[model samples]
Target: MSRSHIRHELSKLESCLRKEIGELANKHQIKLESKQSSLCEIIEVLTQAKLCDEPLFCRLTKLDAAFCQLDIGLYGLCADCENEIEPERLAWDMLEQRCAECAENYEHQHRQELRLNH
Candidate 1:
């Protein structure tokens, strides 16, 4: 795929993520202010919000980095192996920084580490 096309996709992803983050933040704030629930219930809500917000924030950060890389003509290349990421995967998620193989390996290692830590 062309660099222009990739840039366009990344832009769309960034816009979508920003909108989602905004909505999530707004919903969390509204829930916190309007809900009159038990402390446990409030904590549960907060925990759920945190779980959703954290990942969105992470994706936003990654999208920002991808924009920077796109500006520098480095987008679509895997961070670990420096291979061009598959077009289909890029279409699915422009923020992904690893090729399929590297991503699988990274996820495997991460899971192993999580198990060991547990």
Candidate 2:
């Protein structure tokens, strides 16, 4: 997908999240600090209240980070290796911008570290 397409999709995701989160909070009588909260604020509230599970929280976190990187023309670059992220990963999860090799290595490293600690 094109950068424009990814940008548009990210924007749409932000809007969708805002709308759904707002509705959920209203329905539950949750008190958000801001009536017109920011994307970060929404994330914070969602996290604080445990309104969503790990996968959704992870997705939202990735989306938020992607938006931050997009502003500086770094949206689809691998965070670990400074390479273009694989198209397959991008297609599967628009916010997963890590190249396959680096991602695999990173995961392996983390797993090894966990094993050593445990």
Best candidate per lDDT, number?
2
Model 1, C-alpha of 31: deviation from truth (Å)? 14
Best by TM-score: 2
Cα lDDT for residue 103, candidate 2: 86
Model 1 lDDT per residue over 23-111, tens place: 66586673542133432443345466665357765676577678778889888899999999998887787788899999999999999
Candidate 1: clashing pairs of residues: none
Residue 72 of model 1, lDDT score:
92
Per-candidate TM equals 0.70, 0.73
Query: Which residue ranges in model 2 land beyond 4 Å of their true spot?
Result: 19-30, 33-35, 50-53, 116-118
**Candidate 1: where is the Cα deviation over 4 Å?**
30-53
| Tens-digit lDDT string for candidate 2 (37-78) | 777887888878886674555776888899888888898899
Tell how far residue 110 is off in model 2, in angstroms: 2.8
